[model samples]
Target chain A: MTTRTVTCEPQNFRRVLSSMCTEPHPLARQAASRFLATNPGDPTTYRTVSKLESEVVERLGEVTGQSDVEGYIASGGTEANIQAVRAARDFHDVNDPNVVVPEHAHFSFHKAADVLDVELRTVPLTERLVADVDAVAAATDRDTVLVAGVAGSTEYGRVDPIPKLADLAAAVDAFTHVDAAWGGFYLPFTEYDWNFADAAVDTLTIDPHKLGQAAVPAGGFLTQSRKIMDTLAVETPYLESTSQATLTGTRSGAGVASAVAVLRELWPDGYREQFETSMSDAEWLADALSNRGFDVVEPTLPLVAASVSERLFERLRKRGWRLSRTANGELRIVCMPHVTRELLESFVETIDELR
Target chain B: MTTRTVTCEPQNFRRVLSSMCTEPHPLARQAASRFLATNPGDPTTYRTVSKLESEVVERLGEVTGQSDVEGYIASGGTEANIQAVRAARDFHDVNDPNVVVPEHAHFSFHKAADVLDVELRTVPLTERLVADVDAVAAATDRDTVLVAGVAGSTEYGRVDPIPKLADLAAAVDAFTHVDAAWGGFYLPFTEYDWNFADAAVDTLTIDPHKLGQAAVPAGGFLTQSRKIMDTLAVETPYLESTSQATLTGTRSGAGVASAVAVLRELWPDGYREQFETSMSDAEWLADALSNRGFDVVEPTLPLVAASVSERLFERLRKRGWRLSRTANGELRIVCMPHVTRELLESFVETIDELR
Candidate 1:
């Protein structure tokens, strides 16, 4: 037998600036390594990681102004959003279920609707690129089980008109879900009333991996009560426990531990300072891009959407600039913590030379 | 901010044998840490990890004796199985779809059926504790989109008649899926012909976390043809790449990297030696338990299904022996690579004293 050992040397992996959220915190890495062998299928079978998961849920609730929140750590935004739709489908007891969302909602909503076979009714965005409440009201009906709005949309990072959407959903007796996967952690630091305290949201999808600075694949699903969570639980007869409330079986507890560690370390003040700096950096980048004759949108939640020609986009992409684009073909640059001023300045210098 | 770091020292976390797989290979840890910040969402955005994920898929295909197989890493068994069922549903274009499986199949099937709103028809197991081919034939009909069989059932670790089941599925033009989440890696070393080279299976769900000794949350979904994989792809307009063929968005590269590392380290010879040792250990443990007045079934894989009373189970569990039980109340002990002879000897000594 060959005595082989796999080692990941620092030189083998070069860090890039396009990766947002900075590097994972030291506490998060250590926590992940500690719980690498744990599976949070049942608290009874895996007690340590299970307790850590509960504490993480509690911290998420307290910070989001929903003190009674109940949920589990999902794989990522996709699983969390799918679970939210499933909860809404089961809770409303509708025969022909459908989910209503804005056209600018995350692609995860589309994946969820397709997987669940639920009709996805997408409302067109308003002139401001937010979910138009009038359109949502027009799209929703008796069969509509869920009406969702985004806190930080993927395209423009604009917060939707969630309060108005919630009112409309309440009138139709539909469950309201807020997909705050990218913007949940930042909303607390901003002066926006987008959390559960200010809205009539029934479920929320928060991803710690996005803005919370945890390790990868740590998306959370939160609801107001256990009665709602029970709808997604499945019975696992082989294990010591009889039931599990997760979309995937044998989930890794590493993500949960890393998220809890990061949240515990940077709770009240550290994250706020980081959010402030990231938004400021975004504003600075947007101003630089606009000054250089590129049409850029105003900054919101550390994301700047700009219009660039296909030729320029190809050039920038070939030069190793990781970029995102909207359906309308607007370029998106998320000024995460890792996207420093020096990197943006260098990018601007290149754009100036090209022009 | 306080510089409080979460340290996971070895002594701080105790190791328990209830975990089926051994501690992840050191290479797996290094790979996870190296790619902790990378995601496999878009190949253009995260080029290195995306390429690595593709190589891992190709390696998985070659190892499973399907050189032309195409697939991606999933979150776990549940997601993989669900995606297979979804592929079948979409490819066949069935208005009212249903899946037929043996009664001893994993509960993930139930969850998939519930989420997809597809009717699930379960055939009873034969008296020999394996999936009865005749019963499976009786349960499937015109509306059946999928016919699935378990390579190693969660309860008794008995492999179903996959060859016969696949023949039956082919007769009705249904997509055949083999859920080898528990037994995929082992079958390569055994004399069994349960791989893609031997059966007419369309899709297979193999979890590296179970038997491959990779880190957690590494489930794989492989298809016989790329045409079938295209059915599960969703267009993501925001990302540079317009399409994705995964259930979750922003999947962790840690699982993929770790899985590839371990699979490379232990391929043809290393896994065969480990499997032989594990099987021998199981036989010895089963003999010891049978001699101590317990009714134990001869194992097909490295699992012993013993008939033990609730009282004895409670006593053994209290003494730190993590045990599993079947729906019919039979005790289960999976003799994985981690469950060494010394551990079995200690368990036997305790049972000897109790008897």
Candidate 2:
């Protein structure tokens, strides 16, 4: 939080593709350490860190194409999504409020629906593994307060037709929410129009920890207007600030500071370079798996979901490769910034030997 | 999370009384850094950090005097409190559910009430600033689903009559929750029985960041039964595990590992000694302020709330004292583990000079 600038050279993560090896940029870690004791929930005391929160929003705005973005650095995408839906539900005129989300939307939506006491209308995806815009439109009515679309889905890395979904939500007077938690950082470099500038999104969920190279728990929640944000505000009687919009209080300043450092260091250029390499790796892995006669999904983004046998998946786990499976039981691999071609080669060689 | 043991010498924070000075033990910080990249939300991938989370629950159960406590390392007290109320509301048979809380319960209860769409009935405290048991008994009805009592309230460090509150809630078939987020670690050293072993508390909110000297966001939420916890579980479809009871989907492993380190290093003896020093500091400050003709609330625990002139409060803020005021405009001071006699002496001297 002091004026002492931390110097951290980026480290090469030449290890396994497990989330554990998804190391942050050194400066981001240093910033987290320096601000370890500060609490951003009470913004008055940690004024500088609080200001850094604004800078984080500013950078996030630049990335998401919202010039006047207003939001906080959240614990992760889950909190961001929860708060977004809470805001939408707070202003609903009907007693039985419902939220319509894509089938591939993050499970955080389900958590939000349960905690907020609202009906969750899950619209199934199309054959392309993206949201069925027509189905989403059909599920909406007067009681629908929110309609959510996924920018980059968890299982298959599929991007929904956000512009069409936004129009459907608008016709029903429902706020549009974009779950770009996994794609917000990478989509900026690519030709994806999933952000605010591309659609009428009222709120967006983006994570700095995903591809922004920040420490964990740096999820960004951006709101289009003050009315949307103030809907979530609660009075704080014991602090200098009268109201707080965040879901949690007394949080570590690690995420806020780390997000600022990562955004400052990697905006546009550094991140663009990383995304290129990661995209190539994902494409390469998809092709390599296809050549080996394995059923693989298209890697539109830097993520691969392939149909691997149960025995082979267990063998990969035994080799210390932490892998995840999709809802349909396909092996899911996210080509994060740390995932390299070298690691994928080793994975392929192991598959051949095991098969 | 690896087998390598970390040794951290406890550092003396003789600098300031601001929350920013509330640093964790050095080893706790080291552990946080080591596990920064891991996500505890997906337990199957980060198996070791997830195991450490169980160990954290074990240590927390010992400290809270509940041999079998079921909970997770929450983002902070805010999440723990919200989840506790959600669990209570989930199983309520009544069409309209209400929660009864003491006057000084943390504002997070209000946040929970707003988010969960439940009625909040706040019972005023007695002249001694503790919960009014009679008023709490009168507040509960057939629609009441939860009764919450505060242990070490925010503005004033006062413990509610948990036994009486629990009894009243049980008579009405409502769950009882204790918000010991600020007092859990210190009350074990004191004579307070605000935990499950002392009362029929269905859920307790405690923070390892507050007195356990862990990293920030290391909040402990303990439940009496697996049935109570299961009420809040939501299906995490994409994760390795099927269901997760936590409110958030992805979280840093920093708080989880740091809590384990702090609990392991200071559980019975180190924290006991620290409590002795902190309690004395609170009492000493109360005496010093009273002798100076300032009206001071009794520092029952290690927190003091005193009446000071508006000009004096502003001057202290100008002097870089990160102070907080109560709802009634009284200055509140929390003698965290970082607060020493010397720092209190400096604060008192500054107050005298400014006056």
Candidate 3:
């Protein structure tokens, strides 16, 4: 077969402020090249890669403060969150089950409700744009199977009061899940109490692709116990293995190997430096935008959202500046590794001129 | 950060006969390296890679005989098949819905039923190990919202009579989906009537990772019309785009780029030659196994299944000859790209010596 002459050179993605994504570490890219033929779907077929995946699960568990964590590498946060919902529903065995999440929760919760036929009770956020424990208390009942807390919400980048939310859900024995897809790796570098060490929390959705510099679509789901994880296991006679407990079959071994490689490269010190740098850059950007008359939300991770006029938003976007807008029309910027101080300064300069 | 010294060299995967998997084409591996930082989730941020993904969808649609097809890159066949079921269930306001599939269908059908709260009615296969169209007709009724046919069954590589199955299901307005994950890329090389050109098939689960020589997890879900695909769309306010119809959010751009690279390398002639060589190899292996007194199932693709005693299966497995087994105890062997003639001949000699 003739290889095409088409060149896929990486474009200048540094100006992409809208996406909460980063480039994969060089080691991860190398690992993906090394394991292109492997598939982790059947552990027996690719034992080496499967072991790497399990190591990733274990290392993520340790970061979340769980000594004995049970989970797998999911496609991404959507599948991880959906799998968490499946685990909660099956473990509880309640009829017509419902889940309680804040209105600011990820849209994947809605997808899960639509797919699983579970009633979704979305509580209104507090004035601070965080999940209100009181509202969650009012929404839960004996039939509530799961209650989710958003750590580092997409728009505002605020960590919900997970400890309080878990306490509220514990009264009814509802499973607690923290969607740390954007916050899990960052929280370890901060003094936040959003981890498995919280006794009431049951599951966590962490994406290595977002902050850990893994290749895309590598979402990690960590649970409190193997029993809870096994609730979603289904038999797969067609595969070399007798059964599987994943959202998809025939998944990529490349994703697993790449994640392991990246995690190993940034185990303790390297990741902290990256997180601190991003946070510092975001703080600077927030200050600059505020000085220019923009009311910016205090970033919990490396995300800064500001109340901007629609005219300004449209003008900036028309100028080829990629920015995400919240439902309330706030301009959102995530300070990933690529989002350097120089890029933000240029963006600020552009904004000042436009204003 | 220090790069890890651990090596990830590709293993001798030719013995992995149980998997319907192949090494990614050289172009695909090169593409993954070129586009390691790109993501297809936010089109505005990764416009070029997103266009590549759409091109993949378009080319796959053309191969499946649908000129105006609408679809996306799914996680794998499971997500593609589940999305097809979701579209069918939502298109028709199905309540207490059931899907009728053949007994040899992939386990993803069972996963969909579990996740969607839909009942699965499995019709038994005929004596020839193919879907019994009459049994499917007898099993489906007013509540049957979808009918799925397996073009390439996992255990026994046999194409079902999809035309007959579709005619039977269309009598009651049930949606028709063909799980061609293993056979879609192969059928264009052979004379098979299991495509949308047949008029009865509505959706196809075609996996590039399985036979198109793309990286793992590159499953394509192509629908006959855009109207049906709209049923699966859900609003994603956080994304640059307004909504998403995919099973995942923040998916890897590597899979999409790799698939397009592989497809471009083997568009019309290159893929046909690969399939022909694999089919001939499969025939040779089947004949050799039969001559050694093992009863072999005639392969429709590059898969061969033979009945082996439990002791023999264990011995072969202990000797590192990877093989899959059917629910009825038939050992399966898939002749992928890496499974060369020399490897098969060595395996046969080993079996002869053991016998």
Candidate 4:
């Protein structure tokens, strides 16, 4: 009898292993090595998990100018959104709570609503592809527990008018949650003063894995009010002696340690420098794409979304440039710390030639 | 100006580091290294995560002589129970769904109910501290969606009469979930011929971190029916992407890698030998405790719970022995892979001297 053997592709193997140690910098590697050498207990304890969580939150508070901040480490942006929705719903005591979101909001909001059985009210976008605050205000009702404002919406990478959304939410006594998963790390360092705390947003979800180059599963839920976090606490003696304030117990301390290492290494100037360079690269990519006759959306943010006139995307793919598509038929090229200006310029040149 | 410098105690520093890496075994170290090297995406996915969830179900199928078995990876035992409760509630569609559990059942079941807002009925235990099947049968009602049987109750580490409980669940058409979190990795290799799938269990929760010596955050939920697992799925555009099928998204591929490495390193014979040795150590500990006149609870499986006569506990603590207490004044000591017969014997000798 003959047996078949299964094997994984070499590139895929490389990508997977690289994801384990996502940090490009050497300090992150040292911190991870040291952490693995030491802390090996279950990371569910407040003493261990909370200390790391508070460290991240404290740094975020300093960056955003928010002092009374309470945050919890989560698996990713999705879990953070789910927990935020749960807290908002339980706080408002809405049996069939509703969330008002822009059409371009991240899919996490829709996923949160689906899991919690909360009604989702999708508002139309403005001409600039930003959330139409008026549409959101018009959609709000007494049953609305949360009004979501997108900070760097996935489609166009344009931040919603958070101040206007906060005002609307305040008028209706609804909670304002900013989906800052993509923009939280950038906005604070970028010239844009779009911090959720300053805009009076109640809750925000941020992913360190996306911008900080930490390993996967490093995300957080930031809220100005501690009361909101209290509502999500579930007591269990099996995993936790006290109440587990997060969605999952027995979390990986390695991820937390990695985040701490990344934050420590990139204190004040490091983050600012990286953010500036990425933003500049985004602008350069946007200009190149536009000069090549592509309609680029929200050319200001670190994400450049463009619509190809011909088979430019196919040609770019052949040249080894990977990109994701938005619901609005726009291709999004996100400029991370790893993507250099030269690389973006070369890719844009290839696109122009293909067009 | 003199600045006050903060200093950490050597023990405290060691404890802080130890919290991240709880197990002090060489195998755990080797596994962690291999885990760190594995990636969570594609080709590395198999090594990153113990997609052995399906393998476990397959093993269960073979053990029970049942063909239909399904399983999913979970963060830990608590998450597994939470999902099981959610699935039961949604599948049964019972208004104010209730779960019947023994008084000594792991607290995760109660926590799951509290989080889901489902009614929980705790049946009283027998004099031996095992689940009284008749009490569980009497506690059932039309509102009950699940009857939970603990394979190893945390207090006394006694396996409930699962066969009898399954018979009772069948009588009422209630779904039976076995919380074998501590015992799942042990019973398969031990003398316990009871197959979880054959014992009328619709679902079983297992923790590889506890007994299998994998990294923390490694657990699983095994089910005999794919239909049950389907009920926990939250279908939304954002979360229902090609990869995720659980409550969490973007999990640590490192933890998954650790689980796979631990499981692979300890296959059929490895598991059997380790568990058999642990059982023997447990038996030796029980005998030593009994000889010292401590009211040692008889071994339910491999666990030995004892009442240390309050005065004896204080004396043991004074002698530098760390032990956990139960609700009913019982001291519990788990014999993990890191714990050896020598350590158990030393503790027993100390107890004898103190007594």
> Chain A in model 4: its TM-score?
0.88
Q: For each candidate, what is the lDDT?
A: 0.81, 0.85, 0.84, 0.65
Best by DockQ: 3
How would you order the candidates by lDDT, starting with the best?
2, 3, 1, 4
Displacement of the residue A287 alpha carbon in candidate 3, Å:
0.7
Candidates, DockQ: 0.58, 0.42, 0.69, 0.28
Query: Highest TM-score: which candidate?
Result: 3
lDDT of 2 by residue, B1-355 (tens): 2221111112323433545236788878877877777778888777777888998998899988888889999999999999999999998789899999988999999999999999999999999998899999899999999999999888888998899899999999999999999888889988887999999999999999888888876888899799987898998776778899998878768888888887887888999998899999999999999999999999999998899999998899888787889889898888988788888999999998999
Tens digits of per-residue lDDT, candidate 1, B250-300, equal 787778888888888887677788889988988998898888789998888
For model 1, the superposed segments whose C-alpha errors exceed 4 Å read A1-22, B1-17
Q: What is the DockQ (computed on Cα atoms) for candidate 2?
A: 0.42
Put down candidate 4 lDDT per residue, B16-85, tens digits, no spaces.
2112123523444444543442323222233314453444445435433356767655666777887787
Q: In terms of docking quality, how is candidate 4 classified?
A: acceptable
Candidate rank order under TM-score = 3, 1, 2, 4
Model 3, B1-355: lDDT tens digits are 3446435633548577888878788888777667767777677778888889988998898778888888888888999999988887887776678899999999999998888778899999999888998899999888888999988888877888889888877987899999999888888887777989875898899998888888776888998877877788888886878778888777767778888988887977888888899899999999998988899988878999999889888888888887778888888888887788898999888787777
Using TM-score as the yardstick, the better of models 1 and 3 is: 3
lDDT, residue A338, candidate 4: 64
In candidate 3, which residue ranges exceed 4 Å CA deviation? A1-3, B1-3
Model 2 / residue B41 / CA error / Å: 0.7
Maximum-lDDT candidate = 2
Flag regions of model 2 displaced more than 4 Å.
A1-21, B1-21
Model 3 residue B108 CA deviation in Å: 0.6
Give the 10-residue window scoring lowest on summed lDDT in candidate 3 chain B: B1-10
